[model samples]
Target chain A: MTQGMSLIVKTITRLVTSFITLFGIYIVLYGHVSPGGGFAGGVILSAGMILLLLAFGREQTMKIISHSALVIWDSAGALAFLTVAVVGYLAGDFFINFLSTGEPYRLASAGTIPLSNMAIGAKVGAGLFGVFLALAIFRPGRHQEEE
Target chain B: MDPFMLLLLALLAFMIIGSLIAAETEDLLSSVVCVGAIGAGLAIIDLFLGAPDLAITQVVVEILCVAILIRVVLNRKDETHRTHKDTFAVGSVLLFLGVLLVLGGWAMTTLHPFGEPLLAGDQPGVAQQYLTNGLQDTGAANYVMAVLLDYRAYDTLGEATVIFVSIIGAYVILRQRGKLRHDTGNESDS
Candidate 1:
């Protein structure tokens, strides 16, 4: 039962997972200029990871992404976000954009906004994936009766 | 009404129908899917209302919610066992629906029509200020991003903290359960 889906689904998941992750990164990086931002992109990214878990099973997925690593990544993302905000306080205001604002519409224009978005993306993606992993791995007491 | 307005109205009707089905459905899976459909419909309506940022967020949120719900449903029993229907329960539900209809009708009559600005004498509202100066002030072309991360960053930070704390809570609760299971398994083995 833990073996997950058939070979076809696994193969398709392998083929598309990278692209989905890439698209998610694209959304995060271009959040200042695009429709999708950190939260949306992060959810999409975790969805891709979840798709992998569904296709390849929990054991195989955990081998690639250990539980401890997920916790670390999740914390790191939150810390990075807080650090960005704290850095703004150097300029006398909390979360004030202190970095030089380049020309508008450019990728580099949104001083710390893009960085903040990336931090949020990483945090949200890892947090959601961790939640999914916990829920999926949990077996209720009722399931033991069937066995 | 214009074609766009008609389309939006149609979408709203579908959303209402979807919500009704979701509420009344006997099958848990179908009910979850119906709710998801309503969420998607709401995202589309948000898009039509010229809030692409909200639309994007709504769609992604809907996807995440549906995915989590499906995961939960997969583990649980498929059949939804309804409790014995009582006359009191039925009467309360009907009374509540009737009251809701009356209140909704009254609110609609009293409130300003949809698509109109809320503030009567708009002396350049906050939204207008954000639209005009968001790009120049924040150097982010997307006004929503600018507002969320810059103009109203405190609120965003608070939300992020809440999410972080919630995740930690989940981790702690699950960890305790796993440890308890391990201890029990070892004792049985011994």
Candidate 2:
């Protein structure tokens, strides 16, 4: 139901959405060394997508990332996380720390934690955006009810 | 009181006032903006309380919530105007809310004072162990991430599954062209 906004708002959105996405990636990757992890980062990423949906209109955004592709990403993220758990189970425990615990504070140190963060980030971002898209598409009572 | 205490109190008061305004606003778009302000206040309070992760999440959520609510409300039918007022219903609801707030305030008094965490007393709970040895065990600087993904990875997996299912549920509920449409019902056009 959303249409492209005024020139000023669209220009501002184009400039800011990429920065929001970049910060989300930083938060997800450096979650072990800093505060935000997969969940917060993923939500931010979806918020960036929502911004795009608002600024450029829903049809154009859907062209970039289709519904089927998003669903695939959502399932893939969940599967990847479960795969990490099963790997630990192969090492004789449910969720044991099976990998090398490198020096703390380093980017590549947090054994399975960072990997989990990435998987969770992928899933949460995709899933939330997909939900938003579905709801937006089904929105009722707009003046332009053209299918 | 200390400056931090005063600042936190001020932020809480701002959030309370914002919520009241959001609820009372007739225009849905203005109400969404008011709720966004309350969210901004909550994020600042989280920062002051030393929860950077929560603050970041809250700010992003504030943006997303405001965006979505604005989208939903803008160019929509006007549903706020009412033909009649039900004073008794309004009075009972206000009375109920007041009683709940008093009970919540009294319950907050029973909890430990600020900045004093209640560990499992002398024995020191698993949480104490996590804080003490999390870095050595998980090799992560942030213990919160370590706890979420390493010590309790199964829980995260379960949460991911739940999210995936809920997303699917939303799609099923919102899809317009999938199955039979009950055009005969209250729906004018399906």
Candidate 3:
């Protein structure tokens, strides 16, 4: 009975975590038309990562997610955003809408805004995950020291 | 139900969840995380209400604050060591605060009067025009960027100066002035 209860709890947690993660991605992609944006979406995504860390051991999680990779990705994402903004300035004026604006309220529309949002999403998501990993590293469990 | 009603429901739900988490968590760090989560939710709600400026600022500031807290908590020696008395005291305090909050919120709901659409206009107010026309005039799509760069360029300059000043202050406090002094055997004998 105890084992069954534990299994149920684990399944529920997985469901919740997956839902939040997918929801976060939806928010990041549809931010311009909806309430969620880069920051909120990024944090929610990180919450999923945190859940993974809790369910899977820290070592297993770290095997998949490296701090250095996250840092590099975050920096690159930020640089991409800055590059686009700079490109706008070099082309004509600062922050010019470089992409062709499609039909109003279309997914393809928003003219570089969506791209910028994606860049921000990447940066924020990686940055936050980095923060959590750093925290875990600094506070390893007692069993870790013994090993 | 109206979209506004839905938003209000979400906000209220968040408030309740935050209160419950804050109340139930015996660990200070977990309570702080709950508070941070609540703050992030509030910021999202603000964005939905068409206040991106406030939302961005809140999100960034809160993340930095949480990062600092995480750093501190990780470095601390004690993770969990709470007596029954401490738990009781914390729980009682949380309950009292929650009740007081509920009363205040109820009063606010009753006393508050809805206002007209302050932003209803064709030409758009100074703020709106700045958001719309700033891109055309100064060529920036990010509404915040347009506002900060063209309409409020002076303010941006001031903020940049402040950032520079803070950086210098930090360097002054943290930078090493001299090279490390090594003690060789001869030097120690001398």
Residue A56 lDDT in candidate 1: 90
With candidate 2 superimposed using the best TM-score fit, by how many Å does residue B170's alpha carbon deviate from the native? 2.2
Which regions of candidate 3 fall more than 4 Å away from where they truly are?
A1-9, A140-147, B1-124, B130-190
Location of the lowest summed lDDT over 10 successive residues in candidate 2 chain A: A138-147
Model 2 residue A47 distance off true place after TM-score fit, in angstroms = 2.4
- Give the Cα error of residue A99 in candidate 1, in Å: 1.1
Compared to the true structure, candidate 3 yields what TM-score?
A: 0.54
Each model: TM-score of chain B? 0.81, 0.82, 0.53
lDDT of each: 0.86, 0.85, 0.62
Candidate 1 chain B least-lDDT 10 residues? B181-190
lDDT (tens digit, per residue) of candidate 1 on A89-143:
9887899998887999999997889999999999999998988887776555523
Candidate 3 per-residue C-alpha lDDT over B1-190 given as tens digits, one digit per residue, 9 for 90 to 100 = 7888687678969967996997688776787698788878878887777787568657755765576576456545545665567888889999999999999998977653543344534546776666556544533345554354334534533443453345345334333333233544343211
The Cα error of candidate 2 at residue A43, in Å, is: 2.0
Q: Which ten residues in a row have the lowest lDDT in candidate 3 chain A?
A: A138-147
Kindly report which residue pairs in candidate 3 clash with one another: none
lDDT of 1 by residue, B1-190 (tens): 7898899989999999999999997788898999899999999999889999889889888988899899888656657576899999999999999999999998889877777776532687777888888878999998889999989988989999998999999877655233555435445421
Q: How much is A143 displaced in model 2, in angstroms?
A: 16
- List candidate 1 stretches off by more than 4 Å: A141-147, B78-81, B119-121, B176-190
Q: Rank the candidates by TM-score, best first.
A: 1, 2, 3
